[model samples]
Target: FRLAHISDVHLGPLPGVTYRELASKRVVGYVNWQRNRRRHMHDAVIDTIVADLKASQPDHLAVTGDLVNLALDGEIEMARHWLETLGSPDDVSVVP
Candidate 1:
């Protein structure tokens, strides 16, 4: 059976904030990229990964934590969408 290992995708239309928001432009810039830019490399990467996963027809897929940037409440829905896309819980690892 084929198995796939995927981790830390951090897919987002709005990247999570950081403590350095008060100090780091890079961090803030990332948020802007995620929100305003409309298309990020990360988004493309995710599309490619999901497409590949579907095409590969892996028997199972493993998501090894940190799937999102900050695990914020708002991100849950997006995560669920991806999970649903991948397959059922039996096909992928359960969160809890």
Candidate 2:
């Protein structure tokens, strides 16, 4: 069977929040996103990857950890949507 394994998708379109929302480790993550992560993490890349994966038509897909960056509720929600776009929970094995 053709199994496609992917990890660290880091789905984008971060939620709107103020500085106070960023607490503890979130502060570091917010800073990183503002400084570097945002630039490198592109929706185009994800779209391309998804299109390629769809074209490949893997029998099963394995998605490892780190689907979100800071684990914020919004990030989690967005990731959920992203996963749905990939496939059903039965078709994709998510480790995150």
In model 1, the worst 10-residue window by lDDT is: 15-24
Candidate lDDT (C-alpha), each: 0.68, 0.84
Candidate 1 local lDDT, 8-95, one digit each (tens):
6766765455565425455555565557544643678788987888788899988776555545555667777877877888999844
Q: How many residue pairs clash in each candidate?
A: 0, 0
Model 2 CA lDDT for position 51: 84
Stretches of candidate 2 off by over 4 Å are: none
Alpha-carbon RMSD, candidate 2: 1.2
lDDT of 1 at 83: 76
For each of the candidates, the C-alpha root-mean-square deviation to the true structure, in angstroms, is 4.9, 1.2
lDDT of 2 by residue, 1-96 (tens): 899888888877578866777877888888888788788787888889888987899999999978878888898898988889899888999998
